[model samples]
Target: MIEQVTVTPIAPPPAVPRASTWAAELRATFTLAWPLVIAQLAQNALTTTDVIMTGWLGPEFLAAGTLASTFLMPFLVGGMGIVGAVAPLVAQARGARDIKAVRRVVRQGMWASIVIAALLVPILWQIKPIFAALGQNPDTTLMAEQYIQIGVWMLFPALAIIALRSLLSAFDSTRIILLITIGGVLFNALVNYALIFGNFGFPRLELRGSAVATVLTNLLMFGLMLTYVLRHRRFKRFNIMIRFWKPDWPRFREIFRIGTPIGLTVLSEVGLFTAAALLMGLLGTDEIAAHAVALQCASMAFMVPLGLGTAATVRVGVAYGRKDAEGVRKAGWTAFALGTGFMTLTCILFLTAGPLIVSWFLDPRSPANANALGLAATFLVVAGFFQIVDGAQVVAAHALRGLSDTKVPMIMAIIGYWFIGLPIAYVLGLVLDWRGVGIWLGLAAGLGIVAVVLVARFAMRKRLGLMAGLG
Candidate 1:
């Protein structure tokens, strides 16, 4: 006796004035983006803090720390990319007022994170051999191995943070996320200084100490977030943890289906840069250090747009769930515009203060480190050239994800980063003898292609109307 369901379609309301609609979109987008921006910047500060402190320890130590992070971020971001599928799904469900759906998505996302963590832990433990195979110096490779071994446990908590962050962002609850991350920065600094140099009777563990600090910081963030979600007055009704141990195959399938492509998309992009870092290592310590420093600078600036991209996903996802095509278009375009405008400002800073900024990460007065400063400056100039496009592409990708559209973007990323980017990097940097500048240019070129393609895809989707739900 299966019941037949009859669905009634409701007409969308009258479209608002163009100026009024855009103004509202801009306000809503910023409201969501600011807290996220601060949170992301604070999060990036943890690594920047590590880079700064490690740089004081000297280039070999800096290179070791940078290399460990290089390997770590790709895995971390890619896994989080999967878990990040929770955000849009939860946002849509919440918009539709389906608490059961949100809970199911959250649980499955947690399960997936656990699986990713298990796989990543063994890889962390076995990284030394991988480092050697990649032609890294034996001394720094050993140092990096110690660092990763002590801190790999943080990976689980870090992944949880992303899941939690995604859920909270979907609900427009970003203030707590920002507060927790900002507090973690101060806490990280305290632990890093005390442990790294043995202040306040702590053991001077050097590079290993920073890893310990980072691990502790990651755990603290997860604990704080979890406690808030479980106990907060505003969230009592959600009861996200009501079903602590249960298997819902259908729900898990949904999560995996949407998340896998996202993870692949992130891997495609991160893989390109990770390969660049490895290639740079073969050049010399100075070259690797320069590449890392320049990358760090670009990454810090990137956090702004990245935050907006996340906001775009939430905004667009909610609109999609409510079947508001106009709102979807507004949200996507607002985020893209804001991201591009902000990157333009950062580009000016990079172009104007490129050398001075690069010098901050490496001691210009030190003879061995001076070469890194110069090369990093050149890389920053290239970074400036591509930032607008980079921001646009990230925003566009997230906007598409709002519609549960990841497969094509993933394919596009693979084509751009691997098929186009890496080959150009190798050709210009190695075969043509252009070195670091050539590698950066190749990266910029890849991003430009990706940005154009993604934006065009999104535009086409708009032309076809997004109000009609995508299958």
Candidate 2:
């Protein structure tokens, strides 16, 4: 009795983490990434349909449309990046089992999106003058302006959709995202067909009609997404919009804090590519066409990594929130493995099927297309080498994003893309007279360097204090 009174029960050793195995992690990463990958493809399809319809109007319309997109995408992407901060924040909150925090984050994210849209819409609305200042073809600029004036309204719904998608993604509800996007693609096609050519008694608005179709399609998609989130039993309980007007200044600021760097990072990369395009323009029409074809192939392959990277953000984020250091490592490396592995296949495809892929984009039998086809096939070979690095860098960056790391990555991107990559391209393509091959080499070098640094940053995260938040 005395011993019982004096003795305390021995505490059990801290339970092991039951860390997920690589096979399990791989399966989890794949499950999360596939829907996102398909969704990305569908989103790209939406744009492809628009381009195809615009081309039907004439090259002038196509050029105008392209110009509008080039100008519009930076703003749209930047804003979306800002709102994209919601994904990691939500994932972290869910991992921590902090339901209230989740709702607050989603709400603040929507508020942030609205504010961003308000600021950007007006700027995009004045597309005419901006194009004028850039000395774009006046008629083309005017036509682009028509499209922008109507289509710019899409900024609101697009950003809103991105924010909501973050919530869906955290819950493993991404299949709906794929469904909505596919539906939007089909809807966009039908509407474009009807309105652009006045096929179904719709007005022959041409470029403007495409713009109208875009606005309508976005609005419809946003509506459907909103409805699902509000009605779905799992999501509705969050009451994400219960106090839509309530202010969460700290959370609002947090989004911008985490997001601004991402926006700038994106702009930097896009600028580099846009500059590369400009450089290609100097070579000749065939070079530009070939570059476009090769770039498109590279871009499609990129969607896989991009989707995997996004999944990494969610997985790593949940681990980060739980203070599970090992989980974070596992999630990150698993995603890296999946992304780079897929890219390896694409690299092989590009290397082995360069000519065949080019054939899909351009007729190999056409005498006029021979030069473009040959050059595109050559560029694809170079694209093959860069694909692996491209996959590595993007997934690494997004994995860091799970740690709420951005500013450093943005700096890295700026240095790698602008300073290192751009100069190399200029010299190799122009100064050294390497032309398109030189330019592709520069791109590969830039991506490789960025991949190296980013992967290192992730590996050294513990020592660098990036994981100081771990509980």
Candidate with best lDDT: 1
Off by over 4 Å in 1: 1-20, 462-467
lDDT of 2: 0.83
TM-score of each: 0.94, 0.89
lDDT of 1 by residue, 1-471 (tens): 001112232232222222238988898889889999999999999999999888889988988988898888788888899989888887777555566666677877888788899899988788899999888899989988889998888888998888788888987889999999999999999999998989999999999999999999999999999889889865655566777578767767777788889989988888889889888888888888899899999999999999999999999887777667787888999999999999999999999999999888888888887788889999999999999999999999999999888888999999998899889998999889899888888899889999999999888885645445533
In model 1, the Cα lDDT at residue 135 comes to 82
Counting only residues 3 or more apart in sequence or on different chains, how many pairs clash (N, Cα, C under 3 Å) in candidate 2? 0
Candidate 2 collision pairs:
none
Candidate 1 Cα lDDT to native: 0.85
Residue 296 C-alpha lDDT in model 2: 72
lDDT tens digits, residues 1-471, model 2?
A: 000011222321222232478887788878888999999888877777776677556445655776677678889888988999999888877666667777888999999888999999889888788667755678877887888988889999999998899999987788999999999999999999999899988879998888899999999999999999999988887889897898978788888988899888877777777677657756765676677667778888988898999999999888887789888999999999988999999999999999998876666666777887899899999999999999999999999999988999999999999999989998999999999999888888888889999999999999988898574
